[model samples]
Target: MGRREIPLDPSAGPVQQLAHALRELRAKAGGPTYRAMAGRSVFSASSLAHAASGRALPSLPLALAYVEACGGDRQEWEARWEAAGRELARSPRDDDGADPPYRGLVCFGQADRELFFGRDDLVDRVVDLMGRRRFVALVGASGSGKSSLLRAGILPALRERPEGAPRLAAVRVTTPGGRHTSEHAARLTTVPAASTEDVLLVVDQFEEVFTLCPERDRFLDLLLTALDEHSRLRVVIAVRADFLGRCAQHPGLAAALRDATVVVGAMSAAELREAVVKPAANAGLIVERALTARIVEETVQEPGGLPLMSHALLETWRRRRGRALTEEMYEAAGGIRGAVATTAEDLFRRLTPSQAGTARRILLRLITPGEGTEDTRRPTDRAELDAASPETAAVLEQLVRARLLTLDGCRVDLAHEALISAWPRYRAWIDQERERLRLHRRLTDDARTWVEHDRDPDTLYRGSRLAAAADAFAGEARQALSSPEAAFLDAGTAARDHESRQTARAARRLRSLTIALSVLLFVALSASLLAWNQGRSSGPRPRFARSGPCLFPPRPTSPVKTALPGP
Candidate 1:
């Protein structure tokens, strides 16, 4: 039996009134113990008991979990919880100078675990899989909170080390890029192997291996080899679902993932509510029920919308009233659909013409247009931009400051893939120049391959392809080309022109030979006709000499007349 709880005075305050209502709810349902309540919800027994303690307002998730376990109407309890939070916010306490609990465009990390909610069940499942498997694939759509699940959810849970689990010597998180190698994989496992303790290596954005990495096969082979050789090494890869087929192309990875894959899908209504309201409550702020309802309504139907919801909540928090995040602020910030667009467009409109152009180039460079999959963020090198230009530098800095882009070391990438579909202006830019962007991407890859082959002439473009590339990259568009790509195009153009000049010279020589042959033939035919005419004249002289004896011929003709009369 549970300990007897103190009765709450309904008239005391909002918190007390809420506690009294919960008690009455329990009574109406024939009063289950906190242990029984915990079995039905994702909360602890003590957490269920604390909701009715009346010492403070319970978090919306906790209150809802309590109500649901007790067979009470969740919508009614959620409203009551929001009211109590508002009353508590109105009554001031000493300021602790806490930072905003909500993460904007960025994902939740281990540091933000206290404010992270809504994936408890998912975390447990992943952690359990990790206990039995050496390789686990966490696949999800873009903006579906897979990264957060890995970092904030699974990382924290692993650190806590449930019951008999082995202690991790190290946890390293890396995103595969253009230059990954076997050596990189060796480095990740070195420490754990030496210490004879398990290590967790999380490969986030694993799709980059296909999109960006040139040594993807070598890298993948090394990771699989490490797992096979080292019993202490564990690998967790978070990849977009669209890349699952790509992973299947690798036989070793396919075998490992057949049974060791965890798929993150859309959040349920209850989960979404916890994701929206719990963070604000942790930061000592009230989220108006209307605002919560509006946010949930906007996000529930949108698949892979966690990032949009987080960004919207962050924007609303910025424009929050003294202690409450109201529906008015959410509307003002443009809600889930408009928040990212509003922020991006407003920044773009403030730039000068040249700066705006630079911004466009920078943003486009960070995106890799899709072939059969959705468009994704492309991590770029700082050296790829024209660092000499002040506008280029300024636009890059401003974008990083705005959190629309992220700068890590010499690499720059879009803050999230959600930005691709969320901002209309950026989407239009991609749509308008998608073909050109694809051409540029191919050129970039070809340039890298050319350098890899020591600039072999056979690798250079020729003929019609060269002509098309030259036309497409003419004028200002050429500035988008990297040094290697520009060099490649120039070499291809020069080679094609040289081939064309040689062809033209050969054509002229053939024309001259044909003219000479025709003249010789005409001369020979004229000579043969003259020879025949001279021969005929020399032979006819004897016949003409007999014409001098005309008189004798006349006498013969008279004698011949007498013979003709007899006939």
Candidate 2:
């Protein structure tokens, strides 16, 4: 539903107008969502989405199905379709394929600007604020449209610099994900055409520096240095508000944020309406008034629910009929609350058991266990996954295609943090392994650090620390570990056992030596007594002088004749 855009090239021909008219019927019918259409009609949602896609003329039966799903008169729409076809403008250009208005979990990109809506004010504020300041941190909750505002809004706005603005050099946008800082710097530091006015360097998803990057302190130092090295360099980082505290730990970032932070929040109802209606309208489609109100009301309740709203709209779009998204469609897609989870669970259950297990580990890697903090999505390297499973790429691609997981270049991450709470199975997994997961993450960090420090034996786990880690891996959730992590655990356990065995051997050697010395003393004492008896009268030779090493206690070598006088 989310992937289908409406009335592609709507005004071009009667066929296109017929498609446009079809969209309007659905709009009039309270914008029945495409999901609803699929549920109520014989056609699939994808089929329905494609029917109006303008790629190929839909079959008459399909057209009738579309009208029927929208609660329209089939006879009227059927006759109307024929009439439009009579003079149908056959412009070679077809609206065969179109993108959807709602991005779902996908962040708005430069190409998606035309459909990005509802954040005009936020976008303007960001550009205006960063236009003057050298450094500005844009903060917002997850799914608050922060990435969209930066990507679809500010970047284009900067490119469209207005009069009276000072701009000479280039604009460089990059993410500080571990893999790219050096590249970002190399590109960002280059002065374009001898102009030093300002180079706008945008680092989106700045939180990844902590959650995903291994070189946290080093990356931060490099970034801060870049910001300070030139006054003409303007740096803008779009980050989630939850990580603001982590950001503030750095003195330079803290000072910059003290006065130059812009926090994006939920939009008002009017803004939400604009968001819901404007994109479809722009595409020659109408949104039902009731649908708009319903989306706004449901979205506002979830604070940072824009992602969910977008996804729901996407689902609704798929189920959309003639010209509109309807309440029935939204309900069919499980409303705002159920849509994302439903989609995710469906994907999960369809996988084979082995692939499903691989997926769980893959997803668990995507999360950073919060010791005392909230668990959040972690960006992971595809290489780590590759080491774990040969099937990694295929599973990764499937989830990425499903939008449950996203793969950007070599990196992989869950599309949104909301997925953590939205999916029941995911929540259950986290609950069952909270403590163990924390330990697992810590062990992974320690192992990496150990390798970085030349694999020092001193850094290896020992004693209780070793036991706890081993015990954790032996637990039921051990399968959740990546291959390297499992190997690390196995290596550490081996080292511990080796150390314990060496200590045990040393203790045994010492015990044997003590027994040998005691026996030698007894023999020496007996020999001394024999010499004394042979040299002199065999009276109990005057007891040896008392000293620390008395040769032997005063005991007879032979049984005493007067022993226990007939007791």
Candidate 3:
């Protein structure tokens, strides 16, 4: 659809004036869409609109995005967006409840070392590995500092180098649907297939290529092959640790990771402390030692430890007004979950009810398993959404604008796991919907089979009944499996062998004791019988007989006693 052509008037307020000017600029630039404008600017179209409308203040990043899109002076817009952002920061929106401080990757304070600590060694290692092997995979659990380190540490560090150019070409392909993959390839093709010097090409959240990708997908393989084959390009992939196993299932990926792989684990205690404490101090927020210690203690050993946890702490700290961050506040925040929950709730609370419903549906669909495989954690594309409902296109756009869903080409996925796990109601809704979809598919399959085979009336009747039952079962299955609670049940398997070894050992000991006890009892009973017999012999044999046997009784007593004596 064409954009609304609003006439620009000179006499308007600052907010209205900005919007009017932006519209005029778009028209003058051959009827450019927001995407067209946003493509040129550092700010997204939605962010630009929000900023210009005065609904939210513009950020330097947003201004940069907007300016770049409009073909306007980037330096000028940057200064403007920065000024507006500071003003917007002072005035909280009505929907802004006690929300966490994580706005997005752009809003995050990565330039400040305090706000972006840890991963010093890893960053160096990756850069070094790239220099040596021309490729490196930063593999880690979700919430690991892969993205953060790359952006905050590596990118910034590269920019700081005296020899580094002002603009070092870096492309982060987040959403790579099949169609988009071709476009991405085309973009890469334009870069003049690397020379002797390596070009750094980073694929962030590389798992998305698999998670959201369709079956028999060659996009990832092709991209990897291209990078590997190219002599001048250094490819760095940030993939989820869990998905690393899935990647390994492919021979190409297995070989790549083996040659150049660095699995990012939880930061050490010292690192965790630095990550938490430093950022707060830089933001003009005091992080108490006790509070930092508690955060580190609770978070240090956890997978992907301090990144999300640190953000949660900072977010909670921001909401506390002037109060020093305390242990009670930390506990109440649910640590990582609390931070994520707060952020999601803030974002969700800002959305319309309809928007929330669409987001929920998308999440459920994403989590549901296909016939042979599981749904991706990454965002779904139009085709994938069409399998669920017709409104997917509209819903997806709405979600993307809301920042709940990310888009790379046509594919979509949840922004983070906290959104799914944060609210119990949302979690329940997803579970229920997934169950329904599962059941529907099963019923459809059974019905199709029955329709193809039916002949006799009796057979037809039976087939129809069976089909109906299948349908019912499918629905129940969808509802049952959709919920996290049911998922937990499914995941609740017997403990690992190592975990159960102690119990097994105890059982073995009990079995051995039981056998020993039984043997002892048999021996005791035998001894008792033997002792009784011996005592009877020692006491002498008592003989009783009738009158006719009286004569024989005396002989018998003598004979019996003699026989007993022998025994």
- After superposing candidate 2 on the true structure, give the runs of residues whose Cα lies further than 4 Å from its correct spot: 1-97, 163-168, 177-193, 225-230, 387-390, 450-459, 533-567
Candidate No. with top TM-score: 2
- Shift of residue 458 alpha carbon in model 1, Å: 3.2
The TM-score values for the models, in the order shown, are 0.73, 0.74, 0.51
lDDT of 1 by residue, 135-247 (tens): 89999999999999999999999999985445689999888877654567668866643676777788999998888888888888766753575467788999999999999
Q: What does the lDDT come to for candidate 1?
A: 0.84
Show model 3 residue runs off by greater than 4 Å: 1-114, 161-172, 193-196, 215-217, 226-230, 305-308, 328-332, 342-359, 366-376, 381-413, 421-426, 433-567
lDDT of 2 at 188: 71
Off by over 4 Å in 1: 1-98, 164-166, 181-183, 191-193, 226-231, 452-454, 509-567
Ranking, lDDT, top scorer first:
1, 2, 3
lDDT of 3 by residue, 1-567 (tens): 445544544353344455555556655667767766676666666666664454333445664565556567777666655444333332223243443333331223245443567668776766666655655788877666677777667666655642422233443433353435645754663444343343456677677666434432566555565345544445677877767767889877677778788878778888877777665565556767887787777776565444457546655564343435655455544566566555556656765776666556566655534334333354445454542444556667756654556665665666555455555666766566565556443433333334445522222223344444434445334342323223222222222233368778999999999999999999999999999999888984444635454553344334343344553
> Each prediction's Cα lDDT score?
0.84, 0.76, 0.56
Please give the clash total of every predicted structure, in order.
Answer: 0, 20, 24
